[model samples]
Target: MLQFRLIVPADLTDEVAELITSTVGATHLTLLKGAALDPVGDLMTCDVAREAADPLLAGLRGLGLEERGLIAVDSVDMSLSRRSDDAERDAPGDGADAVLWDSMAELTEDESTLTVTYLAFLSVATMLAAYGVMLDSSILIVGAMAVGPEFGPLAGICTGLVIRRKQLVARSAKALVVGFLAAMLVTGAFAALLDLFGLFSRSQFERPHPATQFIWQPTADSFVVALLAGIAGVLSLTSAKSGALVGVAISVTTVPAAANAALALSYTAWHEVLGSAWQLALNLAGIVVAGLVTLLVQKWVWHRQRGRAAATSPPAP
Candidate 1:
């Protein structure tokens, strides 16, 4: 279940209360009139089924509460109220399957930003992948993939496309491109330093490593794997089942390819660099395409469900 704390203007208190009471999946409503000092409004709180949260939030936003007041939502890990159970049971769909769009937008908005932490993680992941490629260790490659933060920008781009938010698209694109470029450059320098210390060699990269050769080899399978991973990744994010993301992370070769490209550049291996770049581009394109399609399908399904719910609901007095 989702809990909402809303600060509403004094005049709109009755209207807001009526809306919540009429909502099928809302319960445990509480209101403290004139309790909001800063906003000078009433403090209202309620719990709603996850499936019903989106519409309820939309209704509240339509009332201008978001502009004049505050709307904060939190997940209820444990709700002891019988009304909460009833609310969940009466909701249109299962809670886990419901897509809380507002929540998703907020999540992706924060993740897509190019923060210093993001750059640090990406750089470290790329460097780890470079070592993994040199050693031809699948385990290290998977580890690097798990550590990479590329999926955030990918999801952000998909969300922007679905919502038609140009600013989000621009920001996500910039983050992805700049982040990858910066990571690759830093990993390349790291590779050169390792070579100077005799810890890495061009001969290692040129060796026939059957286990890790796939990182620099672009093929149809690369796109297919990335496409499948993209679907799973987006679903995990939308459903809030984050554990599934680890599997998605390891399924794609994005970080490994970028690492391979950087390593090859350090050794002046143009052919390997080109091949790895191709692999990176192919995987990225496939993921973004698949992610966009998955989100679009989800939006369509939810819209249809919302329509059916509205049809069955009784008219307001």
Candidate 2:
């Protein structure tokens, strides 16, 4: 369930109350009139089932509450009330399966922002991956994948395409491109420094890396794995089941490919660099395509479910 605290204009109180009362999956409604000093309006609060939250939020936004007042939503980790159970039962769909587009948009919006933290994480992940490739350590490669923050911008791009948010699309694209380039450059310098210290060498990169050979090898399998991972990653994001992301992260070779490219560039291994670059490009393209398709499918399914629910609901008196 989700808890919503809304500040509503005085004149729209009645309409808002009526809307909540009539909403099927809304429960535990409370009102405090003239309680908002800043907004100078009534404070309304309610608990809504996750499945019903999107439409209810849309209705509230349509009333100009977002512009005139505030709408804050938080997840209820534990709602012991029977009314809350009934609300969830009465909702049209399961909470885990529901796609809250507004929430997703907000989440991706924040995650996709290009910041120093993002750059640092990407750079570190790539650097770790460089060591992983040199040492032929699968564990280190997986660790790098888990630490990489590339999925955020990829998800943002997918969400933007589905929601038709052009600014979001542009921002996410810039973040992904710039973040990867910056990470690769930094990792290359790190590899060069390691070489200078006699810790890393071109011979290490040239050695047979049976366990990690996929990083620089672009094939149909690479695209397929990335596509599958992308679908899982987007579902995890939209459904708020973030644990699934760890699996998705490890399944793709994005960080490893970037690291391999960087390491090869440091050694002036043009062939390996080109191959790793191709692998990276292929995986990214596959993930974006797959993520966009997954979101589109979810949006379509939810719209259909809403249509069915509306058809069965009784007409208001």
Candidate 3:
């Protein structure tokens, strides 16, 4: 269930109450007269099943409550009331499957921004993968993958495309492009510094890495894995199963590929650089393609389900 709190103009309180009363999966409505001193309005609150939250929120916004007042929604981790149970059972779909699009937009918007911390994480993750490449250590490579923050912009791009938010798409693209370029450049310089101390040598880089050779090798399997991971990653985001993101992170070689490319550039290995660049491009393309498809399907399915439910329901007297 989700909790909605709103400060409503005095004249709109009754309309808000009526809307909540009419909504099938809403319960626990409470109103405090003149409760908002700053907004100078009444306070109205309610609990809504996740499956029914989207329309109810849209209705509230359509009524201008959001502009004239304030609206806030929060997840209810635990609800002991029988009304809560009834609300969830009466809702059109399962809570776990619901997609709060406004919430998702806010989340992806914040995550996709080009922030200093984002750069730091990407650069550090790339540097870590460079070390992993030099030592041919699978564990280190996995750790670097898990640490990388590239997934945010990728997801942002997918969400933006589905929602038709061109500005979001542009912002996310900038972040992805600038973030990778900066990380690779920083990693290349770091590799050069390591070479000064004989830590990273051209011979070691040229040597076949039995444990990590695939990082620079583009193959059909790389695209397949990235596609699967992309589907899982978007599902994790929409379903609120965020722990699955760590698995998505470790399953792809995006960070390692960037690291390998950077290291090759530092050592002037033109052939290895091209291979690693291709590997990077293949994985990113696969993820974006898969993610876009997943989001489009979800949006269509949800709308169809709602349409079916509306059709079958009895008409208002």
Determine which window of 10 residues in candidate 1 has minimal summed lDDT.
93-102
TM-score of 3: 0.96
Q: State how far residue 299 of model 2 sits from its true place (Å).
A: 1.2
Off by over 4 Å in 2: none
lDDT of 3 by residue, 279-305 (tens): 999989999999999999988888888
Error of 3 at 80 (Å): 1.2
Q: Judging by lDDT, tell me the better candidate of 1 and 2.
A: 2
Report the number of backbone clashes for model 2: 0
| Candidate 1 lDDT by residue in tens digits, 253-302 | 88889999999888888988999999999989999999999999988888
Tell me which residue pairs clash in candidate 2. none
Q: How do the predictions measure up, each by TM-score? A: 0.96, 0.96, 0.96
* Residue lDDT tens for model 2, 1-317: 99999999999999889989888899999999899999899999999999999989999999999999999999999999999999998788667778988999999989899999999999999999999999999999999999999999999999999999999989999999999999999998998899899999888888999989988878999999999999999999988999999999898889999999988888888988999999999989999999999999988888888778778867868
Q: Provide the lDDT at 25 for model 3.
A: 93
Candidates' RMSD to native: 1.5, 1.3, 1.4
Q: Give the TM-score of candidate 2.
A: 0.96
